[model samples]
Target: MANLFQKIRKGLQLYQQIDMEALEKLAAKVDLNAVVQNVSKLDDTQLQGVMKLLSGSGGHKKKVPPPVDGDFYDLAELLTPEQRALQLKVRAFLETEVQPIVNEYWLRAEFPYELIPKLAALNICGVTYQGYGCPGLPNIMEGVLAMEMARIDASIATFFGVQSGLAMGSIYMLGSEEQKQQWLPAMQQMTCIGAFGLTEPEVGSGAAGGLTTTAKRTPEGWVLNGQKKWIGNATFADVIIIWARDVDDNNVKGFLVKKDNPGFQAIKMEDKMALRIVQNGLITLTNCQVAETDRLAKANSFKDTAEVLRMTRAGVAWEAVGCARGAYENALAYTTQRKQFGKPIAAFQLIQNHLVEMLSNLTAMQTMVFRLSQLQDEGRLTDEHASLAKVFCTLRTRDIVSRAREVMGGNGILLQYNVARFVADAEAIYSYEGTKEINSLIVGRAITGFSAFV
Candidate 1:
């Protein structure tokens, strides 16, 4: 009983360290006699810990969270300082200029013409081309820039790919020096917009063997007839690179069909569920006359058209990465701040699992496309190489966006959330350029050395 009395005196002495007013408030809420009894039961080590905690010397410190970055492997460190700067510049432009109005324009299914001049000012168009006012940067820069653009808006990225990769690449690879001199500079400056016309209502994947659009040679030049569907930028493009079968030779040839041609007609495709900001057009040509001077000078067969597709397919893969990254980042930010059960949803085990899976896929895609661009820059890129990346990245992108939407619940479907846009646009990316089955077959053929593309 004497020892217990001494312990209680020590506990009372510790309580005296606190202000009188604080002790009074604590006494109101807690039974001081009970607390003193409990304190008296503690040994020396336990008493020291309690003293440290009460004095704010050993209490939990506010945690400093790491920044939310999706590049888990830091793949961007591979870029040159200049390239990194350019990438950040493009990202800033998209976030500041495009992000604010994209949902509005996307909702309206209308192109934002105001951004064209702003984009042109970046001087990134025809990024991989060497001459005629082109930037002549490494092909990896092209992939990186495509990612940055699509990270904010896939429609804008599609429009750019059509201009830089498909339209300019056709002329640069197949056109004569004179032809390149005439169009590339103007197109590079974005003063002259261009579109690519290859997919028809009846032909998409079968374009290698079957193009119904026919071009007949005449004294007046060439007369083009047939419909080209899903032509991006066609509604307002100054020039459309129309791939048509030569009537006499029965070979696929490319024509620079000017929008002003008598028979050239482009009608805006309405009510699209994806890529609505892109002014996709259904082009009708009733004897559309393209001058001989305007023909892609050296393009004589579908093999030539395949070259353009191979290059652009790699860009599509990067665009898919961008889409996935956007959705993952958005979902991650949402989870960290969005609370449930009196804590952040991100604190939950299942939410962290979803985020980890997304990061894994996104990291895989980023590294794959990085190497794919290296192959392109080295001149070793093949149809199979590009096809594989397109297949894997887009397929993974669909999964990531779906998971992103699922985590967000009903807000996932709302346009204000932004993941809804990625979910819809991913469907378009997966199907366009090449379907999942088509790209997979391309890879399968290369690996097994068997032509499975029947």
Candidate 2:
């Protein structure tokens, strides 16, 4: 009995230690269950076969052809050299810099403020916007950059999206020249951080028509009174763009609320299961006053708010792609390394199916977002277009991450395997920026000429 136990343990260890190519060949020859069942009865020949499988005999030598990358159809080749270089540069940064410490920070639910200066050096903030020290690249560049960032860490990407896309976008789209001149350059350089507060505690989906936060006109300026929830970066942003309904006209207005305003207090929201690295805040505006000059000049109505949502929604889709891609890549690498029955699990047909399915979904999402950004760059994107991509990509991201975790088995649940973090963060993506149900209804409204978001 002791000898048999030793043999089984040795077989398991050998299987766990072998290279992918040898494991693949071994997986084809034996049923792992049968080996376990016959563990005690196995003779010398069987034990030698098991060891051969683990040792990469039977013509197993190469790295199993690089494990079928998730970018199956070479969609990245569509990118120009400059865009491709940027994507690779960001990917290298995430893998080398962020990947090592993100899990620890996430477990502690703390933001890595130290990474800000390093992130600023990437020079990607306000990427698609022109002027004021912004990159002013095409919209496709923005989507690609978001994808690269999310591919490494979704929380980091969300933090950047709030700062660059939501906050900077408000200023670029609605601020007067002086306002943009005053804020954009510093925000772009990461010298001053920013946040956008649009979702109120009582008015999330209904924010378009019904904002509970009210801005009453005062002789001094505007006295704002309302509560904003899930306001990313509000806790530490130097400036926050608060959206409130005007009490007099009932129209939504945006104000630049500085962090130190006496009436403006932002409390950090805690105990989040996902995107823990993003500093979500519950902002209370009790007579928070803003000068008339601080109000956005062009944002006279909710249509301007919708415009900002439309622009950022596409970036959200790219973030979903990144999250899915991250999970898929990690799962693929893990499966190739973890072994059972004297062979790597990835060599099994069923495991390969899971991997292939994940890749297919990830590839489809990448292609869809790439085209979505192209439409955005050409000035032809619509709300429905962005909504459709958001719906498809986020929905698919959930499936991809689940399969990724499944393929990892027990380790999938552990935060260190990488897929686990993606799985948790994918849930947040599923809920935010319009829930799957809401985004689908938005698309349904466009396609069927029917409103379904009751």
Candidate 3:
């Protein structure tokens, strides 16, 4: 009885030292009775945490955005019924299969190998090539497919581009009948993955004028010695299309570099900020001997290489639009649902202005890429045309993603929100496949009737 009385006296003394006024103010801000009922169920540590949150001193996380429709321009109407069906099919597969695992794989900076066969099952590779188990569809369909892939994940779109556009396009355009017959069918089926080794450690926008990677003709075949950087899928691809400078003719040539060659090595690049899921490689070829039969028959000059770039640039433009569209849709969904001061922040005039600007840019980019693909279908596409689209679409994509990040506030930086990935990837798209400055120069030269590449 004496111990119980002493404990009660100590509790009374501690209660007298509490700040009742501050506690009352905090209690007035929320339902004090409900808070009491909830915290009553908590242990001592949890009750302390609850008090910290009530005082606004604890870590607060922003809410994530919900799933949203990205296509604001309704460009699907332009595609034929079959085309639209295929588009929807690809979109559904991406949303169902890829979306669930993308953030996880991207955070780990690793490729999702299990998805390759599933992508191949779609029968979309080599969409424009004839024969060889290819679809032989129009180029517009190719661009549309790229958009669909990128709308969900840019890294997957890049992997597909390396296979279907760069590697297969090289063989389809420049390889001999025997070479095409040997590789095209398996590649078209995605049974054999391929990569393109064109851009070297030191050569990029000025690749036409200079390439240090050399190929020498010998009795055994051609000996290739050079290094390639940023070769997508190189770490696992069965075959790599290597571009090298022929020492004898002083011309650029393409070679089929087998991944199993004793002299060929590909090291996976690590710690990339953008496109983390893409397995880019730094390849070194030392005395790599190849049979003459494996050399691209028609690729005797750099102009042949430019042809592949011109064809692929349109797809890159479409990818930019898709990335931008994705970010915009996510931002829109977040702003509509997220509240501020008892109202949705999107109701404000300033927020509406940002949203309107993003939509306007997105619509313009879609229409431009749509027409660009139509021109490609008509066989009227020039480097300047594709370059112009590349510059415009990628530039506008930066704007759209920026506004998207702005509207989402702090949640914009979190990968769970999706817009952060788009923002990081837009930087890569802006520079690869020709930088904005290089592409703009191509357009500037065409308009002024004078070359300004220097």
TM-score of each: 0.92, 0.87, 0.85
Which stretches of candidate 2 lie above 4 Å from their native place?
1-68
**Candidate 3's residue-wise lDDT over 1-454, tens digit each?**
3453354356545655686676567667998679546655776666667557755777664445445665576788999999999999999999999999999999999999999999999999999998999999989999998988888888999999999999999999999999999999999889999999988889988888788999999998999999999999999999999999999999999999999876899999998988888899999999998989989999999999999999999999999988888888888988988899977888788898999999999999999999999999999999999999999999999999999999999999999998899999888888889999999999999999999877
Task: Give the winner by lDDT.
Answer: 1
lDDT, residue 101, model 1 = 97
- Mark the 10 consecutive residues where model 2 has the least summed lDDT: 59-68
Q: Please write out the lDDT profile of model 1 over residues 1-454, one tens digit for every residue.
A: 4564565577567767756677789799999889877977887777777767766777564444567788899998999999999999999999999999999999999999999999999999999999899999999999999999988889999999999999999999999999899999999999999999999999999998799999999998999999999999999999999999999999999999989998999999999999999999999999888899988888999999999999999999999999999899889888887889977788899989999999999999999999999999999999999999999999999999999998898899998888999999999999999899998998999999998877
CA deviation > 4 Å runs, candidate 3: 1-68
Local distance difference test, candidate 2:
0.90
lDDT, residue 430, candidate 1: 95
Clash tally, candidates in order: 0, 0, 0
lDDT on C-alpha atoms for all candidate structures: 0.93, 0.90, 0.90
What is the alpha-carbon lDDT for the whole of candidate 1?
A: 0.93
What local lDDT does model 2 show for residue 206? Answer: 85
TM-score between candidate 1 and the true structure: 0.92
